[model samples]
Target: MTAQVQSAYAALRPADVVLSPDDLGGARATRHSFSRSLVRRAVAGGWDITLGRADLDEHGCGVVVFDVSAEGHRWSFVAFSQTIDESDREDRVVASSWDVTAALVDGAVDDDDVARLRPEVIRQEQGRADERTLIWTRANRSGRFFEYVVDRLADGAQPEPGVFGLSPYLLRSTAFYSNGKFGLADFERFEHGHPFAVPYRAHMLSAWLLRELGYELAERCAAARSETAVRLDGDWRRYFGLGNATGLGMVPYVVNHPEVLDAWIRLRELPLADVVARTVDRTGPDVPRVRTLLERAARYLAEQGDTEPTPYTSGAKLAAGLRPIQDLLTEYATYGTMGGAIEAQPWQHLHEAAAAAGSEVRGVVASVLTELADDLDDVVEASLTCQERRDIDPKMRCGELRGLIDADYDWLREFDFTDPTQTERFWYSSANNEEPRRAYAGVDPGERVQHAVDVARAVHALSLDLAGAEAATSVGEFLLGHPWHRGAVARVQSVRDLEYAELHANLLAGDFLPLHVQRLQLAVYGMDNYNPQSTDWLRVTLFSGAPRVADLVDGTADDDWSFTPQPSEADERTYA
Candidate 1:
């Protein structure tokens, strides 16, 4: 709202290109990512998270509780751990059992609360909870890594850091359910005047707790096996993160909540623009900081190597692309030192160079630039409570509606709805759990009950109808004559000012990759090491380099944990 903020918004990349699926898919986590911001807030608020209870046997089957106190507010994370057969450990929403189930409660958990939550948390969707519970979630142990860590610790040694080459997680969370799902507290209760008022703060915090719990479970199981077993090395402990497997369930959220999506993209883009603009005029402190961030990113990417090859670019390829950009930055630093005069926006030149390399490289550069913005926390926190309204202006003339579509929805023309492939897919909810699923239109029987995620098709249909209507006809009158176009009209009108609201691609298209949408949402949540298992679902790690429980309690947490590199061999020696 300030002049400076307005200038920053003005500098954002053109909406058409940034909002495209290709660009959004390449987005990486930055300091402003929800998970990173949540950790920063915890550190600033002097939050204390400590283990409250541990009642597990050598097999790590029992209940554990963690008490959390933040800014005089109390909460508890009650976890129920149980050993499960490998075949029973599934990440799908339809899965019946898991290695661990937990809930984040609104108040301090007591004996009665744990006893009451135990049965419900384990039962997942089949169970129920009261309004006091904020989140209900479950995780499965990361098969080989979990066992390797426990075995190494039990032998009074440390697992080699190379063991985490594939993933730096001990457990993979299947889902985190909240917002009145199965009777948990609705978002309205804590959306305001609560410590976790920021949209996904509670969810991210729960994920952090899950990561901590994974470490505890590993240590407990190891200690039970040997008298010499010791706690995991501090660095290794922080290196571990909570894993997550997300599928089609998130695609609809991306489609249905354009306002929320726009806010997230705008917040990230605006800060990046501001950083570039401010730094273009000078080689200030941020110049070196940007270089340092780039170095970290390159190293992290190199360490991660190539993930399972899918349609997306691999980390190794991204690392190779970054090499030239790194050299270019070093050259820029030399020019600044040699007292070179202003040419044509050196920062813009650098960005252009990155773009030429690849879309993923461009995103990496943009994410790094965001780290240099002064208003990151301010912008992110202010945008936390979305004020977007999808209400239609029924009084507006049909001509105006058509004009808005012509200007903003021009991208809709790119798709040919007549082509069977463009309309091949339809999204629907599963009857068993109401989980979102996409199916081939004719091949799948759910087309009759399909969800309305076909924004492109809707806009095309609406435009065709508008062509025949009188120019001065009001949208209300137009909708009254053709009620089928109501949702499309409202959607087109509501996003008139929200440039990044709608994805430019047709979700129903046969070649449309849902993983791109998933990656975008996960990047916003600060997830790392995106390993695509298939086109529709993927595995990601959250809070991988974030502070451990000890750091939060000791007030040593910082926000420089993004783009975490792999731990070196020397790090493992500390435990030995």
Candidate 2:
């Protein structure tokens, strides 16, 4: 961390900060005041289970079963490891082969079950899983790093630490499947009484187990080749993480689950309000702590390389903007206070300063809040819930429904639907495996099967239908005549109170960048390394700086990995 950068953060404190409404916008306006009660919740409960591990061979071409039993419920995470030809190492959603395939079965498994699943699990999308399975996923190794580490360890030496920084994780999951697709257990089955009841807990746990499998594979392969093979260095192990490839297919989720999406954004913003309210003095003792946190964040941001080939975000812009904020923070640290006293709301004051600096700097300031507080865990738990039932108030008049749209979707009304540019793109599924894909409106072959992700056009068409209906007519009465409008009307009624429900921009517009949508959702997941491979798909690194599985399982873990990039090679060797 730079000296000035450290000092500038140390200068921040919440005093009698006050600001006009216009002082806050973008990153600054997003800040909120928080208290212990606001961010706190009942500590999440613990899970205890009998442990089991499989003995995979040196080649890693064998089965590993992990049996877990907690609170009278038991299940197995079954992994099938195999070698893939270099030509088979592709990351697209449609890829049919993988280095490893895994499944979380609903109960304890025996040899008979493994025999039945061996052939099918490897097939991935074409495989058939019974209700016994919870999730089916696959990962491909980071080819260069996997081979490099294995050979070095087999040669009785540690691989160069620098290799871990270039690409951290051994394998990256391309897809995670659940919810009864291809005959697996449906989500509703695991909603109540199941051990993995907290939404997608099954998937999350399965992915973590697969991460463990990756570690085991590398170790086993090394031991197979050399009697003096050594385990990966503990520091290097901490840097290991899972990578994911996401694309346009994930964009529809926010539109389809407006209530859930709104809840997530709403919870995130409230914490900012809470922090702003609680900050006391501009030069308070807490200034040192804030400064240290900001320093870590600034260093992490400084370390990001131009990894994405076609990034939606510009590295030059972020780098250029960060320097001035660092300089300002340095000056503020030395001065002790920006003004004579801490304002009535210092967080808001800080926010305004960041906003004035630039949008990118504002985001940097906003991220610093995570280090300052611990209450976000409760917010994260609340985000997992959704109002599953969406019943329309059929009695509401057509006029009232239109009023809801007019009030909530005013930005949406700006789009000119008749313009070809506004409706130039279409979203569809592939003919082979039904994976979501994007295509031009007139040029694509699958426009006839385009998914209903065009929320803007749907709303426009509904408005036209309502225009011809009687104002006094009930929505149910109108829907009875024009059944096609029911899905759009149901979505609008379900999300009328959700401020961040639908995206304000047109998804089908000529200039629409689906990468923006993917980044928005992934941000909620706390992902980093937003490396875009192209305009269509991108890769991300998760749990990169997080504690290793051994640390976590042994109760010696330090849970402070948020936004911290793995230290550069020099720092790695210094720590070693």
**Candidate whose lDDT is highest:** 1
Off by over 4 Å in 1: 191-193, 280-283, 306-308, 337-345, 387-390, 432-434, 574-576
lDDT of 1: 0.84
Model 2 per-residue lDDT at 232: 69
What digit string (tens of lDDT, one per residue) describes model 1 on residues 1-576?
888788978888887888788887887887888888888788878899999999999999999998999987899999999999999888777899999999999888888888888888899989998889989999999886898989889988777865676457999998898998899998876645577778888998899999999999999999999988877875676788898888898888978988898987876788877766763533567668888998999988887777644776777888889988887777677775222454335566667778888778998998887787755686667786876667889999999999999999899878999999999999999997668888888898888889989999999999999999999999999999999998998899888988788888999998998988888888889997888888888888998988888787676777888788877776676344
**Over 4 Å off in model 2, which ranges?**
1-51, 69-73, 156-167, 190-195, 281-286, 306-309, 313-320, 323-336, 339-341, 355-361, 464-470, 477-484, 567-576
Local distance difference test, candidate 2: 0.65
Q: Global lDDT of each model?
A: 0.84, 0.65
Model 2 lDDT per residue over 144-170, tens place: 678887887777666564355423678
TM-score of each: 0.96, 0.83
